[model samples]
Structures are given as structure tokens and as C-alpha cells.
Target: MDSDELREVLQEAGLSPYQSKAYVALLELGTASARELVEASDVPDPRIYDVVRSLEDRGYVETYEQDTMRARAHSPADVLDDLQNRASRFEQAADEIEDRWEQPELDRHAASIVKRFETVVDRARLFIQEAENQIQLSASIEQYEQLRGVLADALDRGVYIQLSIYTNPDDDVELPAEEQLAATTTEARHRPIPSPFVALIDRQKACFGPHEDALNEYGVLVDDRMHEYIFHWYYSSCLWEICDEIYSSRNDEPPIEYVDVREFIRDVEPMLLDDLSVGVRVVGKDVSTGEERELEGEVADVFYEGDDYRGTREIPLAQLAGRASVTVATDEGEFTVGGEGAMLEDVEAMRLTITSASE
Candidate 1:
């Protein structure tokens, strides 16, 4: 290093400019009188003694009395040790930061607004490994391939997986083969237009990023169950339902189960409106007492504020945002059922199954 650069490094290493200059001058001289050090280092003559004394105190120099105060540089062992230790600590801290950035659970926010969509998607890959019951996703075909490995693992665990994938009509990108998609997803659909990337896990966690071509680029990581419910509807109404089905491991037969109450509502609402009997088994919690309930009953009715069903078979997810419920009549009594994060109903349904569908 040059003399000027050496001086700056010494200052950063906890030496004052005066101390650094005095030490450097003394080092070259082997030993120097106060007057000689002041001339060599450009330190003031009167300040030379005090600067040498300070360097000596810090173990960078040694002082002796020879007619007048004289100083010489000490071995640099201690200073080198401190600098190396600091460098090691900084390296370790950098690794820890990168590790936390890759894992969504390591982040403390229940709902995080992030600048990079890459960060949101990377963490979403980690969250997919933890899925227990379901996975709802919307992505570009390339983004789907990026997550397909972890998604395949989720599928192997019997977690229900649905994907809505989009591609630019002009881009000549090949889609994943049907068998490749079937192995990773329970159901997959092709969305004709590009949309935001979304991943919702068991109605408890969600990750979202704006479409790549959006003017404002941003992402959200949601850990709160109630907060994630909103994203679930967004995926259902805008991404999933409207897309054309391309693959399925689904059967519209009886004994069908639903992890999301909104999807259950969409399918059965028309039957209720048609005055047809639908048998259901609801696994849910009482809204008032928070006690668990497994209700086997007949569908009594369906309610959605500001919506007129008119016996419509296709109920868009938006209508369910209002005070919505599936009423059930059991041997005991009638109970109002609502979806995950439900507040207004008698019970919050975690899973609803259609046991029978009548003629």
C-alpha cells in the first residue's frame, strides 16, 4: 500500500491521524527523537511527544527517554489480529443475511411489502414445502417451472395443488408436457392473459407479485390467516375460475371435499338455489365458543349480501366477500357456516365435503 493509503487504513483501524503519522515516521527511523519525528511526519514539534505517547499507549509504538523522548514502532501482531477478527465477523454476518432472505419463516413480518418480486418468489418456494392441505398458484409458464420441483414434493404428500399458468401469446415458449404438469399439480389451467403471480398455502399463508409488465413492481408476503384469505379470493375469481382447464385429477362426483369454503360455495350455491338437496359434512369451529365441530347435515340455504343468484350455476368469488354463509340443518339444529377467517357465521369451516347430491 502507498504511504497515503497506509495512513488512511491506520486511521480506520482506530488510530488518530497524529498517532498514525508519528508511528509511521518512527517505524522507518527505528528510533527517533521528538524533534526528528516532528520533521519527518509533519506533526507539529510541540505535539510530537504527546502523539508518540498516545501511539505507545495503544501498543503501536514504544517510547524511551534518550536525552529527549524517542519512539520506535512496535511489532504489528496485535493490530493485525484485531483487523483479521473484524473481517471474519463481517463475513459471517453477510452469510446470515443471505440465509434469512431465502426463507420466508425467518422474516418477522406477517404481511411484508417487498420491492423485488424475486425475493417474494424465492421465499414462496420455501413456503410450498410446508403445505399441509392445499396449494393455489398463478404464474407465468416459466415461473411455474421454477417452482415445479417443490410443487411436485407437495403433490407427493397428497396436498391438493391447483395452478393457473399464463404465457405471452407472441412468445414461442413451449409449455410443460401434460405428464410433467399432472405429476406436480392436482389441477392446472391455462389463463389467456398475463396476471399477477400468486401462491396461497392452506388458506394460512400467501405470496403475491405484480405482473412483470406492470408499471409498479412490488410483492407481498402474507403470514396471517385472515390476511391471506383475501389473496385466496383473488386467485379464485381472477386467476383460477376464469382460466380454461387443461389438466385435472378432479371428479365432480359425490363425496368430494373442499379445503376452501368459497370454492365449496361456488359449486353448491346453484343447487341450493334450485331447491335440490345437498348433503354436507363440515369440519369447523364454533365462532362464539371456538370449540371444534364436525357437522353432518342437509344444506338449508346459501346467503350472499347484494347478490341475486337467480339460480345461476357460476357464482364468482367476488360475491362471497360480503356476509356469506352455507346454512346446514342437522338433527340438533340449523347452523350457519362460513369460510376460513369467518366472523359473522355460527361456525368457521376449515373443510367442507359434499357427501351426497340429489336428483
Candidate 2:
């Protein structure tokens, strides 16, 4: 590759422009002083030292105490290997932190509508991979038809697929001739959704769509890590404790119910007191504070009012008290929600208070 292409590749590999150029220059020149690097690489004289120091720290360059101070670049293969290793470590750390912190935020709005088909497909794909024991789907006629491919793929991969469709007077539940002849196939049992409908994948992920004209509108998919963790435990518990409630009866009941908690809360808000009850949990920390204080009792009670509703809620210290920022668990994944003035009382109320009075 030419210099520009090489520079771009280095940048994509996580090297700064100056560092890439200086390293490349060192590579070409073998061993060189900062002054030689600046001349060879066209890096400004003032910034060469900083770039060299950064490159040295990043393992792309090494410093030597010769007659005069000198720096030498590591081989290209060695540098690229170092960069790849660093990238892998960073990604692993991010994934771990996200799983620990971001899942709770997603659960708070688990029933929110999903409008984008692409998002639905992406979430559904994730749900399929996460499913372990069972998949129960209650889909609109159009959505059910559209997802035939996905369902067939899952079945082919050995996933148990159970499907239910809205009973249409004019349509049949069995696969059409063309669909049956297609490359995809599903070992699925079919039924009708009693009310609207819901899709549950191993109870780890759930989706809800409207009863009327659901295919025309959007829906939501809930596969948040925290919710998944909770559901996994719920699914694995002793049958004596909650078996009947947790396990569905294939003979009579719909495999999954479409329960929109937000709608339920909205319809029940009038009965609840003006004060809203909110609970916040600290899930993970991001910033390094040498203090070893436990996050327990870091939450505070606050009140707020709005034209629609007024309520009281507790905001976690991670949200209210700003010392070091931390990640919290949410239904979606790990995210930075609170900390450094992020927890506004009014905002929290607006978020949690369901206005049943308005319908």
C-alpha cells in the first residue's frame, strides 16, 4: 500500500495519524532520533516527542539511551499483532461492563413500541440465538408469513419452534404449497392467539404487537441481559415452587400472552397515589475511584410534578450524586444513565409515572 493507504490502515487499526506516520518513518529509517523522525515523517517538531512517547507506550516504538536519546519502531507484524490484542482486550472489557451495567435501563421501558422493521429483525435474530429450550410465537398474518424464513432457519438449527397466528376467516394456518416447497422448513405446531399476540423465545426474550392492524404498525422486542438473567433463573427454578405458573400448557392456553406493562400501568395510574414509587439499583462502575465504598444506600427519594401526573421516586446516587460515573443494568444492555446531574426529578417522574387518567 501507498503511504496514504498505509496510514489509513494504521488509523483503522487504532493508531493516531502522527503515531502511524512516525512509526512508519521509524520502520523505514531503522533507528532514528526525534529530530530525524520529524524530518522523515513530516511530523511537526513540537509534537514529535509526544507522538514518540505515545507510540512507545502503545508498543509500536521502543526508546533507547544511546549517545543521544533515540527511539526505534517495532516490526510492522509485531505492531499489528499488539494492536489486535489491545483491540480484543478493549472489546472484551466493554462487553463485560455492558452486561453488568446496561441491562436494567432496558427493562424500565421493555414494552415500548418498536417501529423499525430492521430493528425488529435484528432483535429477533438475537432472540433466536439466545433461545435455549423453546420458542413461542404469536404473530400477525403478514409478520408470520414474512418470518417463515427465520423460523425455518431456527428449526433447521435444532431449535424447537411453536407458532400461533391470528385466525383469519379467509386464510389457512398450514404452510402454502410454495412455502412448503421452499428451502426453509419448520417443525412448528400452530394455534391462534386468543387476544392480541406475543412472541417469546425461551422466555428470555418477549415481543408484543397490537391486536388490530398489528402487521401495519410496529412492535417491541425485549431481550435485555438483566431480564434474560432473571427469566433464566425463573425458568430453571424447582417445579414445586412455581412450575405450573412458569410452564405453559400446550393443549389449551396460548403459548405466550401479549402483556404490555406500560399500557397496564397507564390504565392503573389513576388508582395509584400521586406519588410514584421508583427503585434504582447500582449495577456497575466505569470510573476508577480508589475508594472502596459499597454502592448500597446510594439512592435518594425525590418528588416531581407534571401537567399529566405528579409522583415521588428514588434516584440512585449513581444518578444523583456525581463523584465518579458508573454503568447501571437495564433491560436493553449496560448504559450510562445517571451520574453528574443526569438524574433530574422531573425527568424521572415523566419516565416512570404512567398516566392512566388520560387513557
Question: lDDT of each structure?
Answer: 0.77, 0.45
- List of clashing residue pairs for candidate 1: none
Best by the lDDT measure: 1
Report model 2's TM-score to 2 decimal places: 0.29
Candidate 1 whole-model C-alpha lDDT, 0 to 1: 0.77
lDDT of 2 by residue, 293-348 (tens): 22222112222223223332322222321222223234544443222123321111
lDDT of 1 at 305: 72
Against the true structure, whose TM-score is highest? Answer: 1
Badly placed stretches (over 4 Å) of model 2 are 1-111, 116-118, 171-197, 212-218, 224-359
